[model samples]
Target: MNKIKVMQVVTTDKLSGAEKVVLDIENNLDKDRFEALALCAGGELKDLYEKSGIKTYVADLSSLKPGEIKKFRSYLKENPVDILHGHDVKASIGAYIASKGLGIPVISHLHSSYPWLQGASPLKYIDRFYRKKYKLSIACSHMVKEHYLNYNKAVSEDNMKVLNNSFNFNELKEKVILPKKEMRSRLNIKENAFVFGFLGRLLDIKGADLLIDTFNKISKDIPESLLVIVGDGPEREKLESMVKNYGLDHKVLFEGYQKDVYSYLNLFDCFILPSKLEGLPMAVLEAMAMRVPVISTPVAGVKTLIKDGFNGIILKERDEANLYEAMIKVHSSEDNRVALAENAYKYLVENYNIDIYMGKLQKIYEGIR
Candidate 1:
C-alpha cells in the first residue's frame, strides 16, 4: 500500500496554537500509512521540524505576491504531496493558489476566528473563496466553525469539522522533569507564594496588559503572590515596560518563549488567559491538563470549554475589575482552586485526548485523499 503524503503548511514561524496542532499531526501521524512533511513560512518552528527528522520547506508566506506564490508552486512541482493541509487563512489560500494545476486536494484548518473572519469584510470574502475551493475545513472549535458560517455563505456544516485542540496527558507527564518545589526555587519564587501564570504569545489581542493591571490592583494585598508570564511576541517589550512602570519588577516574571512549557506549567497554581479573542486557546487547555485551575475571559472557543464557576471561571467581561475579582475569589480558598482544577482535568480527559484526535484526523486525511 502506498503511503499518503501530507504537507502541513503554516504562515508563522512561531510555535503557537495552530503551529502546535500542525506539529502534533506531523509528528504523530501513522508512519506506515503516511508521510508527513512541513512547509513553514520560516521561523523557529521550521528548525524544530527539521530537527525532528521531517522534510521541511521554508518559504515567505507573508505576502501572496506572484513571486511568493510562484516559489511555493515551484516547490510543489518538484516534490508533490497527496494533500496540502494548510493551517489558518493565509496558508490555506497560499496553498490553494500554489497547487492550482496540480489537482491535489487542499484542507483549510481554521484555528482561530481572526477579527476579519468574525463579520463581513473584504478579506472575509477572499477567505471564503479559498475556503470553498478547499476540499474540507477543520475548525479548531465549534465556535470557530460558527464564526465562519455566521458571516459567510460559502462553506456549510457538511464541509466543516470541529476538531478541538487535544492533549496527550502522558506527553505532559514526561516533559515535567522538575518537581514543583525545584521549579519554584529555580524561578526564585517562595514556597508559600500563590503563583498565577499566563502562557501564550504576548500580543495585544492576548490582553496581557489587562492581566498586569488586574494583578497590580491586588498585588499589595496578596503579599505572597507572584505572576509568571511565559511566551514572547511583539508585545513583550511593551508589557514589560508596563510591569516596570507599576513597580512590579519583583512580583512579575517574564520567561520568554520556552521550548518546553511543561516545566513552567508545573509552577502554576492558577492559569489566566485574558485574551480579547481566540479560537480555542491551547494555553488554557494545557493549564487544565496540568491540573491548574483557569480564569479566562469568555472569548471564542472559551465559551465552549468553560462553564462559569464550573470547570473554570469565565469572566463576564474583559476588564481589570472583573479579572481582579475572579483572581481574588480563586485565591481566597484552596478548595475552590482544587475543585476547578480537578473538574477541568476530568473534562480534558473525556473530550480532548490526543489518541481520539489522531483517529479523527486520520479519517479526515483518508477521506480527503
Candidate 2:
C-alpha cells in the first residue's frame, strides 16, 4: 500500500501553539503509513524539526511572492502529496493558492479567533475565499470554529471539526522532574515567594498588559509575590515600560522565550493566562499537566475545561481588578491551590492526552483520504 503523503505548512518555525501542534503531528504520526513533511519560513522551528530528523522546506511565507509560490507549486507538482495541511491563516492561503488545480486535499487548522478583523476589509474576504477551498477545517476549539463561520459563510459544518488542543503528559511528567527549589534558586526567587507565571506571546490579544497591571495592583499587598512572564512578542517593550512605571521591575521577571518551558513550569506556584481571546491554549494545559494551578479568563474552550472554584479558577472579567482579585483568592490559601492543581492534573490525564489527540487526527486524515 502507498503511504499517505502529508505536507504540513506554517508561516514560521516559532514556538507558538499552532506551530507546536504541527511539530507534534510531524514527530508522532505513523511513520509506516504516513509520509509527513513540514514546510515553513525558516526559523527556530525549522532547526528543531530538522534536529528531530523530519524533512522540512523553507519558503518565504511572510509575503505573497509569485516566485516563492511558483517554486512551491513546482516542487508539489514533481513530488506530489496526498494532503496539504496548513496551520495558520497565512499558510492556509498559501496552500489554497499553490494547490489550485492540483487535486490535492488541503486541511487548514484554525488556532484562534480573529476579533480584530470583525469589520469590513478586503483581506477578510480574500481569506474567506481561500478558507472555503479547504477540504477540512480543524478548529482548536468551538469558539475558533464560530469565528471562522461568522466570517466565512461559505464553510459548512461538514467540513469543520472542533478538535481541542492536547499535550504529551508522559513527556511533560518527565520534564518536570527537576526540583522546584533548584529551579527557583536559578531564577533568584525566594523559596517562600508566591510565583505567578504567564507563558504566551506578549500581544494585546493575549492580555499580557492586563496581567501586568493586575500583578502591579496586587504586588503591594503580597510582599513576597513575583510575576514571571515567559515568551516574547511585539508588546515586550510596552509591557516592560508598564512594569517600570508601576515600580514592579524588582517584582516582575521577563524570561523571554525559553525552549525548555517544562523547567519553568516546575518553578511556578500558579499559572495564569489572561487572554482577551483564546482557542484552547496549550500553555494552560501544559501547566495543568505539570500540576500547576491555573487561573484564566473564561474565554473560548477554557469554559469547557474549567468550572469556577472546581478544577481551576476562572476570572469573570478581563479587567485588572477582576484578575487581581482572582490571583489573591488563589494565593490566599495553599490548600485551595493544591486542590485545584490536583483536579486539573486529573482532568488533563482523563481528557487532553496527546495519544487521544493523535488517534482522532489519524482518523480524520484516513476519513478524508
Candidate 3:
C-alpha cells in the first residue's frame, strides 16, 4: 500500500498528553500505510519528531499575527501535504487556511475542555467557520466532543470523532533490575513507609491542592504513608503552602519533575490524579500499566475508562471528604486494591495499547481522501 503523507500540527512541543500521542502515532504507525510528519511550535520534542523520519516544520504563529496564516499557507502549497492535521487552536486555523482549495483534508483534534470554545470567548462566534472548513474534527474524549458540540456553528456531531489519548507502555519486565531502595532513600521516605504518589503538573486545574487536603484528612489513618508529588507548575507554591497549613509537612513530600517517571511509579502503593478536567491523562494510564490502583475525579476521558467500583476508583466529589473516603477504602482493603490494579492493567493492555489506538488512527488516515 502506498503511504498517505499525514502531517500533524501542534501548537507547542510541551511534553504532555497531545505531544505524547503524536509521538505514539509516529512510532507505532505502519510506515507503509502512512508517512507521518509534524509541524509544531518549536520545543524539546523537535528532535524526536525529526528522528522518527517524519519531516518536522516549525511556524511559530504567536497564535495571532496574519503573517502566520500567509506563511503556513505558502508552506502547504509548496510541500503538498496529504492530510493536514491540527492539534490545537492556532494549528487548527493554520491548517484550515493552508489547505484551502487544495482538496487536502484538515483534521482538527480537540484535546482539552477549554471553556473558551463553549461560548466563553467572542471568537466562539466564528467557531463554525473554522470547524466546517476542516475535513474532520476529533475530540480526545466524549466530554470534549459534547463540549465542542454546544458551540459548533457549522459542523454537526456526525462530523466529529473521538480519537485516542493513549499512553505508550514500556516493555520492560514487570520487575526491572531497578532499585526501589535508592529512589526511596533519595526522597527520604523510610524504607518501609507506605507511599501514595501523584504525578502531573502542579497546576490548580490538576487539583494538586485537593490531593493535599485529602491526604491530610486521612493522614491519621495512614500515619505511616508518605505522599510523593512528582511534577511542577504554577500552583506549586500554593500547594506547598496548603500542605504546610494542613500540618502535613512531614508526610507530604514534593519532588519536582523527573525525566523518567517510570523510575518512580513502582515506588508508590497507589497513583492519584485529582483533576478538574482531562483528555485521558497519560499519567493515569501509566499508573494502570504499572498495576497501581488509580483514584481520580470524574473528569472527561477518565469517566469512560472505568466503572465507579470496577477497574478504578472514580470519586464523584474532589473535596477532602469524598477523596479521602475513597482513598481510605482502597487503602484499607488489600484484596480490593489488587483487584482494581489487575483490572486497570487488563484495560490498558486490551484497549489503550499504543498499537490498538494508533491502528484506529491509521484507518482514519486511510479513509481520508
Candidate 4:
C-alpha cells in the first residue's frame, strides 16, 4: 500500500494556536501510513516545520489573487496531494480552488468560531460555498462545529466533526522537569509569592486589556500575588501602557514569547486566560497537563473541559469586577488551587491526550483517502 500524501495548509506563518495544531498533526502523524507536507505563508512556522523534517511550501495566501492561485494550483498539479487539509479560511479557500476537479479530498479544519472569512461582509458567503465543497470539516471544538452548522444550514451533521484541541502530554512531561524554585529564581520572583501566569497573543479578542484591568483591580488586595504575561502581539504596547498607568510595574511582569512554555508553566501557581473568544484554547490544556491551576472565562469549548470550581475555575463574567472577585477567591485558598490543578491534570490525562487526537485525525485522513 502506498503512503497517503497529506498536505496541511495554514494561512499564517505565526506560531499561534491554529499553526501549532498543524505542527502537532505533522509531528505525530503515522510515518508508515502517511507523508505530511505543510503549505503556509512564509514565517517562523514554515521554518519550524522544515526544521522538524516536514516538507513545507510557502505562499502569500492573505487574499484570493488569480496569479497566486494559479501558482499554487500548478504546484499541486505537479506534486499530487492525496488530501488537502486546510487549517483556516484562507487556506481552505485556496485549497478548494487549487484542488477543484482534481479528484482530491479537501478537509477544512476549523480552529476558531469566528473566522476572518465570516467577518468580511462580502466574503461571508464564501465560507458556505467553500465548506460545502470540502469533503470533511474538522472543528477544534463542539462549539466551533455548532457555529459552522448555525452559519450554513446546507452543512449536514455528518459533514462536520469535532476533534477537540489536545496537548502532547508525554513531550510536555519531559520538558517540565525544571524545578519551580529554579524557574521562579530566574525571573526574580519571590519564593513565597503567588504567581498568576497568562500565555497567549496580546490581542483585544484575547482580553489582554481585560486581564490588565482585572490584575490592577486586585493587585493591592493580594500583595504577594504577581501577574506574569507570556507571549506578545498587537496589543502589547497598549497593555504595557495600561499596566504602567495603573502603577502595576512591580506586580506584573511581561516575559514576551518563550519557546519553552513548559518551563514557565512550572513556575506558575495559577494560569489565567480571560479571552473573549476561543476554540478550545491550547494554552489551557498545556497548563492543565503541567498540573498548573487554571482560571478562565467560559468561552467556546472551555465549559466542556472546565467544570467551574471543579476541574478548574471559570469566570462567570468577563468584566474587571467579576475577574477580580474570582482571582481573590482563588488566591485566598491554597487547597482549592491544589484540588483544581489535580483534577485538571487527571482530566487531560484521561480525555485530551495527544494520542487520542492523533488516532481520530488519522482515521479521518484514512477515510478520506
Model 1 over residues 165-199: C-alpha lDDT tens digits?
88866466556466799999898889999999999
* TM-score result, candidate 1: 0.95
lDDT of every model, 2 decimals? 0.88, 0.86, 0.79, 0.86
lDDT of 4 by residue, 1-369 (tens): 899999998877778788888888888999999998988888887888998889999776778777877888899889998999988787899988988888889998888777543464656677776777889998999988887777667777898889999988656645536789998888899998989889998988898788888888677787898999999988999999999999999999999977888888888988989998888998998899888888898788898989998989888888888788888888888899899999999999899989999999999899988
Angstrom error at residue 346, model 3: 0.9
Model 4 lDDT vs. the true structure?
Answer: 0.86
Clashing pairs in 3: none
What lDDT score goes with residue 5 in model 4?
Answer: 97
lDDT of 2 at 252: 97
Query: lDDT tens string, model 2, 244-264?
Result: 999999999999998888888
**Model 1 scores what on Cα lDDT?**
0.88
Name the candidate that leads on lDDT: 1
Shift in Å, residue 275, candidate 3: 1.1
Provide TM-scores for the models. 0.95, 0.96, 0.90, 0.95
Lowest lDDT block of 10, candidate 2: 169-178
Order candidates by lDDT, high to low: 1, 4, 2, 3
lDDT of 2: 0.86
Q: Is candidate 3 or 4 superior in TM-score?
A: 4
lDDT of 2 at 222: 93
Task: TM-score for candidate 4, please give it.
Answer: 0.95
Model 1 poorest 10 in a row by lDDT: 169-178
